[model samples]
Target: MNAPTAVTRSQTADAVTVILFGAAALVVTAISTVLRILGTFRDQGIAWSIPIDEQPIDATVDSGAASVEGIAQEAMVFAAGVDPVSTAAIIGSLALWALAPLIVIVCVMVVAWNLLRGRFFVRGNARAFDAIGWTLVLAPVLIVLLENVGLNGVTAAMGLETEGPVHPIEFWSIVPLFATGVAVGLIAAAFRQGIRLQRENAVLEHDTRGLV
Candidate 1:
């Protein structure tokens, strides 16, 4: 029996890549959409007690007996209660959350589709890598920005003053995300070199066949 040709092997690999990436994308998108819907309902004052963590604080300033330690260690419990966020803010937040996973899914599919084309073209691959890398990198940044912006807007709208810093960045968690993005960008450079070498070898093989 004849073994598979180089073209056949490439096609098989491409198909596997497409299936794996595509399936992952579909699953993540579905989960994100569902969670977003549920979150919107909770924000609108549905059953949200599953994640409640309440703290008590005493404000004795008006009694002329304010203590520095007590005031500094005070824990504020800011609740939306039955008051819903503005329709615009709710929609915007959900849109941003939904867009994050969608962007990732699209980038993964783009890379898989390019592989299926069987050309190993450097430009297309580079674009895909750049997109994925930047998306991963900027995802955390966008989240932070959106959180702070949304928090300030909603609080102001509700005539509330935040006790401490609003939407503080969790640097420990974000470090890994930024690192992964940079790693992907570096991997794209490596792929560019590999694609160039592959193309040159293909060219040489064609020339040899013609000469023979």
Candidate 2:
């Protein structure tokens, strides 16, 4: 309804700075992940793990022979000589991790920067929110799907027989991201509605003030 106050703009600028710092932290994490993956390709394993079974068990896994111990609901499979499919899958997985957070953060930065400049209800900000929302929904499932492919391929490469089919839907992976994505999507929709209502008002204000 009205222009953002200077106080509001200052707060948004501070928020943008904090968000930039957060994004920087995420970048460091991504770089760390890439380094680990590089070590794996060099035959120094990066502790690349895949799901074993849903049952409770105790295990000590070494080389190939695993001595079982209970460690919650999941178990780890130590693997080497990763297959081409598995390598590709791991690369894809890394890309997803690096890219998803980057996308969401960049979108948030866009919105914050716009608000800091005293512009709200911009269409570009709506698209930013859309990018964030959709990436959240899709990235998690895709990451899991890629990992499963790698897991299966790694097992087959090593001539290990799996207990059952492993390609079923991973609801555990999808749920959290899906929930977050839905929430962001709702926000995106609201942003779009704001744009529809205020774009004309924005135009009139600018025309009256002779401001860009």
Candidate 3:
């Protein structure tokens, strides 16, 4: 049997990688949305009581009666209490989510174009894969950042005093972000390798032509 063509191999690999990254992006988006909603729920609350203390006038008489106010406030403070970091995160996440499908579509089109042109093993395919990988990685990070922002804003607006610095959400977001980064880096390295191979193949082809 004849060996598979370079173009055929490249097309197969590209299709698999694109599907993998596309699935990953979708999963990350879903998880991030759930986390953000949970964070929002955790942030939403009303002030139960405000403690006020007073000195006692006499031994027999106790301290003055405490007064409490009943006020409802939104989870986020739009004016004075807004956290700029969290605000930016929310905005960035929304933007990323909106653009993710378009990015995927573009990546698919690039892979299809390369396959049709018989350039799957060339530098272009590698570059396209690298781009898709990086975009996938970025999508999750943006989503996590948005969730963090929403949580931070909610916590601040709640007026809860903390003894020390503490992050509102669990550190799981970092895990996926780190994984995505590693994947992107690997894909970039693979692209570089593919470019080198393509250059070498072109040189060999030129040498063969000269020999003939």
Candidate 4:
């Protein structure tokens, strides 16, 4: 029994260590992206990368042996030479990509660290999970709103002849955003239940001493 329990603990520690290492690497990458956002201003004209799949642009690329995931992942709207992208669009796009995920990851790491130390059923842990869920759901709303405003700036700056305004967010995106939010919310709900039970058990033990 002792041997098995020890083995389980050792494995869990190793897994958590690996997770922390990977999370650190991601945090570093996100910081690098933020730094690149600063570098964008030094350019003669701002270079913005919009997904080819998202934009209705006539473009193609020869992906000979390289395998790319998602539709038109390798293709991007190379409009830097045409006109400069807006400051709001530039910052909004990077923030939407970098800051939103960064916030969620930091919250998860804090909760995970506490759970490993057998300090899981606390109000703080529940709030952290709650934050994770809401951040996943609402961060996009604010960031994307800013990004859309920036995109419109690009449209007007370029003087493009369009039948109507551009649609930044599409129907397909709503599915993943909704699904992810719900999954995180369920985890938060579980944590809240754990905290409630822990508090109730503590009260019962104190009131009815030696009975619990």
Candidate 5:
């Protein structure tokens, strides 16, 4: 049996790495955006309230006869309202929201920069590959972030709550941060892999040319 070629291993590693990084970047952007929005709402003073059972009382007439009384009350109540905003925090949050798109753009720019810098699996077409890679990564992150933010605001305003240990708003806020981290790692891996594959291909091409 023939030995495994360096080119094959390099290509495989590069492809896998690129895939992982790209996917991770996408996921992180999505998750973080969502979580941030939810957190904002939670911070705004929206909350759930469970009703306390009213105790029964007996009323006695002059004759000493007791009459039972019953009253119905809501089992649960949800209080939704905007939190008092500090000038600094409000400004900061607004700035953060405004700059979110920029963050996504930067991530994409990095990918593009890497590709154009001859860091990806492109032969002679280095510039084009970089541009394409950057675009692919940029679009999704922006869309997901924006959507999550909008959804979070709407949900909070509507005063929706679920009966469980975790609140939907809270879950959305925290879970996305974790997801975003995973995504960042994945995208990084993809970039690394792309670089590796590009190098491997170069060497293989050289070898093949020499043999011919």
Candidate 6:
């Protein structure tokens, strides 16, 4: 295919990627939040942290004492703890977390747009590449960190405690998560290289056309 046609297709694909990924992220996030809300209504109490080498048991929850009304009341209490300032911060962070894939998609879209627009061969995508790399590398880390902090905060605030020895998911799970993050970062770096090569080829082709 001709360069112009290829570029057009590239742009179209990028636009579609942005739209589909963004929409999916929003939908998934909403579904996840809804599921979490429903889960909170279960008879079991939410476990915060796990101790080493022990199976987690139901601690602070009493199914007999739990009621739909009580669940609603507890939700109100939880919401109250999230004051406006904290609420905004939490919302913003959660938005970012839920939209993490969208962020990467947007970055990729921006890089493609820049290439079509004939921006800097090297520098045009520096920021976009950097964003992509860092987003991939830090997304999981930030999520884990935020989740731990949030869990601890809520547990302390609500005086939540597990009765039995709680052994959270083994540290092995976290290792894979971190490894996946690193793998994504590596892929982003590879994409950055490809973008750089594309930019250089575009420049070279332009020069050849000028000479022709």
lDDT of 3 by residue, 1-212 (tens): 11124566766677667667766776776777666545433343321122223433322223545544443332233223446675565556666765665565566667666665555555556666676677777776666656555555545655654223335454465566557656866876876776677678778888999999
**Candidate 2 per-residue lDDT over residues 1-212, each given as its tens digit:** 54554646568768778678867877786887778666555544434555555666565778648686564644445566777777788789888887888888788888877777676777778899899999999999888877777777667655776424445566685898889998999998998888777867767887989964
Tens-place lDDT per residue, model 1, 22-63, is 777778778887886675555344222111234444455657
Per-residue lDDT of model 6, residues 27-112, tens digit only: 77678866654543334433233223433333344766643322111222241242343334344446556567666766666766
The TM-score values for the models, in the order shown, are 0.60, 0.73, 0.51, 0.69, 0.32, 0.47
- Flag the better candidate by TM-score, 3 or 6: 3
Worst 10 residues of 6 by lDDT: 70-79
lDDT at position 155, candidate 2: 71
Candidate whose TM-score is highest: 2
- Runs in model 4 deviating more than 4 A are 1-15, 35-42, 49-86, 162-171, 210-212
Best by lDDT: 2
How does model 1 fare in lDDT?
0.60
lDDT of 4 by residue, 42-145 (tens): 44555444433343334334755553444344332323433334565567667666766676777777776665555667766778777778877877666566
Candidate order by decreasing TM-score: 2, 4, 1, 3, 6, 5
Q: What lDDT score belongs to each candidate, Candidate 1 first? A: 0.60, 0.74, 0.57, 0.62, 0.47, 0.53
For each candidate, C-alpha RMSD in Å? 9.7, 5.6, 12.4, 6.3, 15.5, 8.8
Structure candidate 2, residue pairs in collision: 57-69, 57-70, 58-68, 58-69, 58-70, 59-68, 59-69, 60-67
Candidate 6 regions with alpha-carbon error over 4 angstroms:
1-22, 34-96, 105-132, 158-172, 202-212
Among residues 3 or more apart in sequence or in different chains, the pairs in candidate 6 whose N, CA or C atoms overlap within 3 Å are: 59-163
In candidate 2, position 144 carries an lDDT of 84
Worst 10 residues of 4 by lDDT: 1-10
Better of 3 and 4 by TM-score: 4
Worst 10 residues of 3 by lDDT: 46-55
